[model samples]
Target: MTTKEEIINRLNLQPHPEGGYFHQSYASAETTGDKQLFTSIYFLIESGNISHFHRLTSDELWYYHGGDAITIHMIHPDGRYEVVKLGMNLEQGEVPQFLVPARTIFASTVEDAAWSFVGCMVAPGFTFDDFELFKAEELLPLYPKHEAVIRRYAL
Candidate 1:
């Protein structure tokens, strides 16, 4: 089995602000106005670690690569909550790919496994200006019913 350190070193990934390790794999030269058409990154997260709740301006598509499955927790603008599993087991409702709509608050974790490897692509590309990480205090009032998740995943 590939270790998390090995994967991180092989991919030259750096620690991401939201947790996990990542390396930008692609950035299109073509532009849609000032923003790039798309951008991609190799992302990995270990069990017990989490990608904290964050929102982006563009939609993101995640593709599972290896290691263990990951559960993505999403909190939509209208207070709807959902969990999306990313893995190879289709029979168990695990999908190899999942799409996260733009502006949704989301987070992820690799449960019951050592680590998980995945790739993420963003349309209109991704920019630091368009990313926002949330704190528990900031989200608690808005999503009072999801207090547990908000507290667990928020920065």
Candidate 2:
């Protein structure tokens, strides 16, 4: 049986070069073996990892574990973006998971100055081979600046 402690110790954690952060805890064999990694979770995004935007072939589901609230911004296939708030003081009973379809751009913006804890589960697993990061400096100017509106979406 694979225990959480064992998995935690075997986690294939990696840091993003851009900024913020993305530390992954894997449940599969990414650490060692011929086994396929089925699921994993990523934490924090102080600078938001740009690599996870385009290369991930599996959908990413995120849950806000801590913080005031947050907004989930998704970059559409047509190159547009949509913003959705996760919560404002989300209750423990409330569902915590936002799905970002595979191959789309996704990110979270905090509602306030607090640590935002997010859990991400990627179907079919995530590996360094399939992972790729890209910055948004070139794309930022093209999208509408609506951080203010996104704050309202944060719970």
Candidate 3:
């Protein structure tokens, strides 16, 4: 069995500000309005840590690699709530890949296992300027119905 530390060193992943380890794998050179066409990264999150609530200007697609399944909790712009499970177990309702639309507030967590390794690709590329992290206090009032989950993942 491979340990989380072994995978981290093997992938050369570094601590991510969003509560995980990551390494940018690719960034297209083609530009569209000064931004790359797309960008990708290897992301790993261990159990007991949350990704935190955040939104991006571009859509992101997540692909599962190995380890435990990850539960992605998303709050859509229209205040809709959804959970996407990324894993290899089709019988268990887990998907190998899932897309997160642009400007959607979302977060992920590894449930039931030690860690999860996945790849994320962002269209129009990812930029620090387009990222927004929310606080529990800020979302509590807006999403009163989802108060429990919001507080669980939000900073």
Indicate which candidate wins on TM-score. 1
> Lowest summed-lDDT stretch of 10 residues in model 1?
108-117
Question: How displaced is residue 137 in candidate 2, in Å?
Answer: 5.6
* Tens digits of lDDT, candidate 2, 1-155: 54323333454434454233456666675532443546756555432332233336677777765544555667766766676655444464334667778876555555334435567787767666765454454345544463443232222
Scored against the true structure, residue 21 in model 1 reaches a CA lDDT of 92
Runs with alpha carbons beyond 4 Å of true place in candidate 1: none
Please say which candidate is ahead in TM-score: 2 or 3: 3
Q: Please rank every candidate by lDDT, starting with the best.
A: 1, 3, 2
TM-score on alpha carbons, each prediction: 0.97, 0.60, 0.96
Cα RMSDs, all models: 0.9, 7.7, 1.0
lDDT of 1 by residue, 23-56 (tens): 9999999999899999999999987678999999
TM-score (C-alpha, index-matched) for candidate 2: 0.60
Superior candidate under lDDT, 1 versus 2 = 1
Off by over 4 Å in 3: none
> Candidates' lDDT values, in order?
0.94, 0.53, 0.93
- Which sections of candidate 2 miss by over 4 Å? 1-15, 29-37, 46-55, 88-95, 137-155
Clashes of 1: 0
